[model samples]
Target: MATPIYEFAQIPRVDPAAPARARTRKVRAAGQAPTVGVIYNPRSHRNLGADFDCSLSPHVHIAQPRARAQLPEALADFAAKGIDLLVINGGDGTVRDVLTCGQAIFGDDWPEIAVLPKGKTNALTIDLGIPDDWTLQDAIDALDQGGRVWRRPIAVSPAEDGASAAGMSRVAGFILGAGAFTKATQAGQSAHKLGAFDSMVVAVTGVWALLQSLFASRANPWRKGARMRIGLGASGVPMEHSGHGDPEMRQLLFASTLERLPAGIRPFGALKNGLKLVAVDQISRRTTALIPLVLLGKLRGGLRERGIHQLTASHFTLSIDDQFILDGEAFPAGDYLIGQGPELAFVTP
Candidate 1:
């Protein structure tokens, strides 16, 4: 069977009023091994059908959750053990599921995280400068010797009206995209089957998307975009439209807390850090032709006037007529509040 991308979506809604468990880092004695917990996904691109090596010390605990329902139990068990390091041995989807389930358990006080880039798209690891060959032993050793990189995952919650009666259903992830981005993600999957992974997949899908937009008519999905309203910050200020094409429809919407993407693409231009976003209006083919330069960080000036809007905000709201993607998983179309999750420390060499 194929790996299910919607595993995180199966997680039940968490109550808003329930008191979150306070997570505290485990302190090891001198010369003692630090307690480690690993959430290993057997279905990850690199780990498929391979048995996990069990030669490690007893201090390292590994959990192979076959479904999303088992993630919370595994994470809670880790918390009870006072694990010093939480290693995610999978790609972005696995990271999203772990972080989402861990919210109720770890709250904002999480153990130092170490990600082994064992998936097709390891965007978070790329941002943390983790090498593809990083191993579990390396992560344990890095706990003492390696540097630390701080990052915040983007937190997405349903709008008040669309929320569950108990509370809003929230999911945490690094990359969120809609409009043409959703189509590109679908195309990326096709590239994966052709044996293209990581940056190569990005290049393949990006070039394909650009070509489609350049040659297709305005009625095409690539050029027509999606109908969505983007509100900036807490005040819900309307995002300015450049009067390029249809003011009501945007050609693309991409948001992320990660600074470095897989292909070194800079969609946010000069705006880095915080919650940065790029919203493109239903621009003309002439403007669509400049997307490469914009993504390369070369076409910076007068972007807003040319139908490209790149800005940073504490939070943003989205009301869309079509489905959006978060960490390669599709979410139903609805209103949502997007903000940054707690700052997490990632172990890096």
Candidate 2:
């Protein structure tokens, strides 16, 4: 049998001459129900093949896309219906797929988004301050009564001249990581199998990563890191090196538009908001020993000299020799552009 090639949904082309549609907030009149569209994922960790309840409201619309290829049509239908709220009933990966597909239909004008933490890793929900037990009913009620939090997902695209840039498309996601962070993400899968999710998985995999990096020799994959180059801002200025281990290699690179992280870890140090990134170069074991404190915001002094670099940028370009983790999935390695998507209003209790 021939190997199957899976095709994901692509963003449809829009006419340049067409006027941009205004995405004004729809205010419901007294006793009026808002139009809602939900994208539910049955394969999410918590969903676990269970059927989603579809008898919520007359105005509610639900589409459970079994694969990513079905998202575009579903979102197009929602856009045609002029839904006031867009509910994503899954974990981070589902959110990534929904947003990436919706870009063509919704563009910068998106309906208020609501996320239910129903995945093995709900880091985005932690940033949104959503409880794990939140339901569609809770999200619906909050549509009118709850507050709105503004967030921008990180948008990643292949660089025009990148090796694999021929037919790659832009993807929207909340978290992006590479190098040993990629290895840690792989370990998180095992943690999930042991009944760990969210913060517990973070705690478990984090300790393992630290131990592996601490006790192992510099030649270990955890310490050797991946070879990559980062260029900061629109001008593409080369990122400064801290003169630690090999200047061309970094042990880890983590970037996100999220201000808060699961387990309350502060990898970006004092930097908050916008697109924040932390790059770690191979360092002495003494500095590696301080990883816990560094994540706890306890050690902030002389971090640059210690081979830890954290900063916020409007955008950045990454060229890496290894695959990177976005949300929970991995993307091929190559030159790529990373930036923030439009600000999206998220309903929160």
Number of clashes in model 2? 0
Top-TM-score structure, candidate number:
1
Clashes per candidate, residues 3 or more apart or on different chains: 0, 0
Which digits, one per residue and each the tens of the lDDT, describe model 2 over residues 1-349? 0012212224343343454354445667898998999999988889978886678777899999877778888988888888999999999988988888777678789999999999888999999999989999899899989999999999887786452432246688899999999899999989988999999999999999899989998789899889999999978999888888899999999999998999999999989889999999998889999999999999999999899999999999999999888898888777888888889999999
Per-model C-alpha RMSD: 2.0, 3.4
Question: Clashes in model 1: which pairs?
Answer: none
Clashing pairs in 2: none
lDDT of 1 by residue, 1-349 (tens): 1243453346656777886676656668888899999999999998885867766888899999898788888999999888999999999999998988888888788999999999989999999999889999999999999999999999888775543422336788999999999999999999999999999999999999999999998799988889999999868999999998888999999999998888989999978788999999988788889999998999999889989999999998899999899998888887888888889999999
Q: Which segments of model 2 are wrong by more than 4 Å?
A: 1-27, 161-168
* lDDT scores of the candidates, listed in order: 0.87, 0.86
40 Cα displacement, candidate 1 (Å):
0.3
Report the CA-based lDDT of candidate 2 relative to the real structure. 0.86
